[model samples]
Target: MNTSTPSRHRRATRHIRAVIQILSTAMLGILLLLNITPLLAYAQSETDVTELGVVKLANALEEGKITSVEAVQEYLDRIKAYDKKIGDKPGLNAIVTLNQHALEEAAELDKERASGHIRGPLHGIPVLVKDNINTADMPTSQGNQALATYQPKQDATAVQRLKYAGAIVLGKTNMAEFAMFWDTVSSVNGRTYNPYDPTKNINGSSGGTGAAIAASLAAIGLGTESCGSITDVSSFTNLVGFRPTVGLGSMAGVDYNPLGDAIGPLALSVEDAAMLLDVLAGTDPKDPWTSEADSHKSDSYLASLKGSTLKGARIGYVIAPFGGYDYSPGPESDGIFSTTEDAISVLEAQGATVVKIPLNRSWWNKYAPQNASFWATTGHENFFVRTEATWPKGLAELTEPKDAINFGDIVKGSPKMEKTAVEWVMGDDKQPRDEAGFTAAVNARHTFAQGVDELFTSYKLDALAYPTVAAPPAKVHENPGELLDSEQFGTHCGWANFTGRPVVSVPVGFADHFPVGLSMLGSQFGDVKLLGFAYNLEQAAPHRKTPELTPSLLHTAGSTGTTASSDPSTGSDEASSGNAPFTSSSGMSPSAVALSLAAVLAAAIVLISLFVRRRKK
Candidate 1:
């Protein structure tokens, strides 16, 4: 009698289990669909390729969605639209000379890609190098009209490396005349204005690259630094400027002082900068300073760009370097200090332990000024000798210049050179030309480096953070020399140059409508770690903003037959290759998103199957 009742109960239980299984499977399917919608939307979104980093660009190139020629042309179109004067609005005079064969070169790279011979991450990417860094195709003007026609017979070591890695040399960017001034005013290219604000100056001598990069004139740029040149210009222009350890990259084709000169990247993002560095860093026979680069260089700087790089890292904040109301109290200084504090908080939130580490102000005061003077003199001497030795005879034969043949000649030819020459001559007179004073300055720098090392060792720090330039950029009309009167000018950045350490300047926030930069200084040969740390900070709080005046071109893919609108007020047409595999603003590539969706679907299927089986039991 109980058997019949049990049979009926068993059948009822089986029916209930079947219903539950069906509901669970349906719910799982709905959840999977909901989860993948955003991913699909991201994959289909229209993203401007001009805003892409090196990795994305490379992936696009590999995927055959876009050709190198198209990318190069897009950059060229952007330059044409906004680089020069447009109507009454002052243009960003960032580029000195356009590469005459850029398109042809890009076509060749496209051919290479088609042949399945990929060079590296930089393959087919366009790059802008500062005028001082020699390129075989363009003149190494050093921003002096005197050398406007002086092309080098061979590429600079860094340039050669970039090219070997399949990067196209887009052009040379303008810089201070002979890289002599902080403001990027030149005898050849005139001046470079800030992309963020036309009325403001793009601090130099890397200002040209900074402005160009900020405005998306090129994919990325190469900038050389002596003292605050790289950091200053990058900070003011809201870019990521990396000045690697002096010996990290070759200075063969660059006209820089051996003591403090470095060539690094100015990019829209930290990862791109790191990619550039990965290609640039290594020993070069022409650059004796890089004799140890092979040993010091990382296998891949880009590999270190993890978002968790800041986790468990110790970062020391040096307040003296960031001059604010505490030292030179004022509205501007207060604003800078406030911005810096906010930046430190962001770092702390990103898992970094921030601690205030007071630098030896007396040590900085005693040597920073003298070191600046010393490097300026020695750097000029090196520049003069190097230029005269390496000047391209063919180009010199073709075009005769009115200005002097060398720095010495330039000093006699132009009044602009007078002040700098006097400084050089007086510096030599005071220190006997790289002898007593030079040695003293070097020792002072070594001491400073030791102090920094000790601080890091004691705290087990990953990096030292500060405002790249103590104060905001001086106005366009403000003389850099005059700005030095504020006591904060160059104080924070000069020490990095003097000590030959790696420092990266990244946009922190805004101050009075202008961009403010936070600098991260690392030990010698610590370029990768420094870049990683900066990348982490950048990913956490992306402070870099695209300038309103130089908005992203609507035709960033160059597939559109029509060019970008010349009028700044009107945006360009939707990107020409909108149908091409998309990359989201968050930098997730279409392929990556697809893969993620596939994985999620698989996991969901497994969960649904498990639920269905359990209910059926």
Candidate 2:
């Protein structure tokens, strides 16, 4: 009876199989459409840009994975996506201006590549410069309205070197007005927001460059730091900011708030920062301060990035620099207590041995007043004229820390203004300092550097680790008040500037969900080694993470009544699951699929055995 019904069974089975094939193909088509659309979009989206250093880019170029024009276009598209204004709305606004000639320059680079000529690591890399640095091509506005339209006649020494190294200038970045304060704001340009969280400030005169690099807007960018300008900004924005020992690079054409300032590089990765620093570091006759620096320039910094360099590195931790200072009774000398322990904790946990060391804050307080007196006493008359009377008609009152764009205007009026900005802090008629504050600060700087140097000698330290500040970045409004009055964290950063030490700031982690920086200060001219050490520590700790701007999906997973249990042996437990059998949010039972697969295989095996027995009979 079974043999006679075989033909009928085969006909019914064929009809069912045809239905299944039709449904399966339809489902496959829908799945393919769903997958292909996003992939195509991802390929088309300009956001696929890699935020790599120049060295990495060069490697990719040589490997034929990326074209020079494509790399430049990726960065330009990112800048266009993140830097423009839609309306009364807001975005990152990290870039102050985009290089108009970037495409043309990139075309030239591609042409050079076609001719079998490679400039170097930076041959096709795109970089951004702080607005204070003269690019000659882009307008150099020092984040002030006065210089919004001012353009330099030539590149800064730093910029010239970058171009010679084959790097492309992507644009000019915004900064604090005249690089005057820790908080970043500019009358000429709006504020720069943190890339991880747009609601938060990026932190500083170099904030724009930090945010840009963090968001993958450029390969690298130049940032000038007078005090905590670079470090604090780097910390909050999760980027590498290097403040090279003063005069390690020429600052002749770089705009300055006052006379003395250090221009450096900021990048997404420490390697990229090293690449830029290597190319730009050297002496220049135009800048007198360059003579004071140690002539230990290297052809490339990447050659020295040995991860094993930190194996036995001793890291000094500064709990408080102004903890016990008793000199000035002003607000600038006030103490700030922190909710979290200093950033040294993060550094210590990451493997480097950390030692707590207290600094004499009193010496710095005394030095501050003495230094102010010296500035006032030496230039009182000139300061009064600049502040009390306007030099040119229609010009605003000349003040200390004038805009770099209007610097020329001030210079045109009087030679003194050309030499120094008109600041009332120092006047020729002021009373002489009871104590030599400037000398004391200078001496204290040497003392601080020496104390750490000796500590390094004693411990065979690679670098000293310290908190960029006692706390996370202060509010933008609070920056001015703290700078003018008292800030406990001021000396934490200023000491590096005082000693002309190479300090690299890495985003240690978040305190209260806000970014915090741990700085690595190395011996004089130890920039490359210090950067390598910081990079390794960063890899070990991995403190920085993208901010959660919206409600986490895990919260939604927890709200559901289902409780998925994790397999303890595999460490696969759902963090939100209670210890019980849990239903999946996706309506599929996990055990059902396994049972169905077993049944299908069993049926096939039984049919095959029957067929074999029939043949044998």
Candidate 3:
């Protein structure tokens, strides 16, 4: 080989060779970064944006790895991408009216953070409130067209509390029209499809929240439960739902029976739910029911998450919760009832004792509340008049559940209102309501709850365990036929509602590719302790799978995170494969990252060229 070049050109040749080597190394580094850097950032930032539970999201925001605006924008992007109908079929349809000021609110929160004024863990976090909960900024439609234009005079007490903690109100979600049915069909927003499978029902009235949060449209959400709205919807979507003991929080601005409907959190994990409950559970002067909140509440529900485990816990397995059906949940199907039997080993592995309390259909049938009549709108005369007073004269109608929006106008406007809505609103409100029916219903609930308490005592149990839903959620429907008759929303959930006890529903596993949930019920105001126990089960066997249909919209070319897999390994704090651990690293756009690398390489080439020119000179 020719070893030597002319001495005159030798220095220039060496410089040119050095430039080639540098170019090669830099190109390789860029290629590596194109794969590694973007992925790492996506794995951390964009993935976290779309999939992180509230606790992780808050940490990221506080650490400055993610700005509130970025988080809010990511959610807005998801809603735009997946929250509408696609290919003639309904999409998640989770969100209704998005807060126009969401970005501004986020920017302000970011400013507050930069100025070193952190409100709390919820500071700068985005959340979706159920539409029925009044938001001063957005119309509180309550999922009815008549009230679609009705702007609330003030935020719901809960909304005010959330904002005070520096949480951004992302938007309101759809519900069963007037919250009268188990399915999330509304006159205004129409039907909310399950993100897990768009063909299925989301189980109202917090169904919109269920779909949105499941789809990662927001970090966490608020839900209202008159019966199984929170737990069942959460069950279908494979999220953790906490139905706080009635009066644990105020129901003042919510558009449902104050005596029956309780507002709660629907979140990705037990920790997030507890953190939200920490901010939300307190006394409100507007709600007389919440007078006992100060007395019964813990100092911080988030604190309850510390070092929680199932060790030394006793759980009662109530069998008859699913009554009067050909459905006998044995060791056969892998649904909640069946898989819950599988949880025994998981529970026992975590040092918990499980007892089977086999109360048959007869016992359950006997305790059923007679006047738990779905039609009765008892105790709502004041609410009706109040709503009618706010209604515009042009939209005048029968001043009945009356006040802000006239029911006559509501019925006429919502010509497509579900039959269940028609029956509950018109049949009861228009007719002579039996006031005693409500009283008897309340008394019956007391009797049922007392019996369950006795059962808990007999079993020496810390909590009573049952399926969140009696069966898997039914399909979405045009006719109210099977939707009304179905026990899919959970027949046993009323036991807690009537007795005013707390229940936390966690995703246990999947049956037939759908999530099956296990609910743990604690004594009234025993919410904190029950939460810890539920957290243990969640740790033992996490079944949180991000829905396939509504995946992260991180990039046009590829996916951000893999779907969550059920890790049957017990006693591990790690979430599934899809959920990456939280990190304090911000993400740059792919184009920005690419351009930055290009500029660096270009600078190196320029420097080499100058050296060669000097050598030649």
The best-first sequence of candidates by lDDT reads 3, 1, 2
Order of models, best TM-score first:
3, 1, 2
Candidate 2, residue 81: how far the Cα is off, in Å: 2.2
- Candidate 3's residue-wise lDDT over 237-280, tens digit each? 98999999888988878775745678999999999999999888
Q: Which sections of candidate 3 miss by over 4 Å? A: 1-47, 86-89, 322-334, 369-376, 379-381, 387-393, 397-405, 430-433, 478-484, 487-490, 555-563, 566-617
By TM-score, the best candidate is 3
Best by lDDT: 3
Encode model 2's per-residue lDDT on 1-617: one tens digit a residue. 36656666666556655655665565455446434322232343332344455667777767767766777766764454456542234556778888888868988997898898878668878888898888677777677555566666678889998999888999888887667656566656666766565655566778788877765677788999877778878877766788887878898777543333688877666777777887888888978878855467665676767533565567776544333253233342222123124345545665668766655655445444333321112321232232222123433335433431133343333332211123422232233332455464456566555655666787677777666665434444432222311322443565577567889987655545455667778888777678778778666555443222211111132332221222222234333222112223553222233333445645655565555456445
Candidate 2: worst-modelled 10 consecutive residues by lDDT: 546-555
TM-score of each: 0.75, 0.67, 0.81
RMSD for each of the candidates: 17.9, 13.8, 8.4
Off by over 4 Å in 2: 1-47, 85-89, 257-260, 292-294, 321-351, 360-461, 476-491, 544-617
The models' CA-based lDDT, in order, is: 0.70, 0.60, 0.74
**How many clashing pairs in candidate 1?**
0
Model 3 local distance difference test score = 0.74
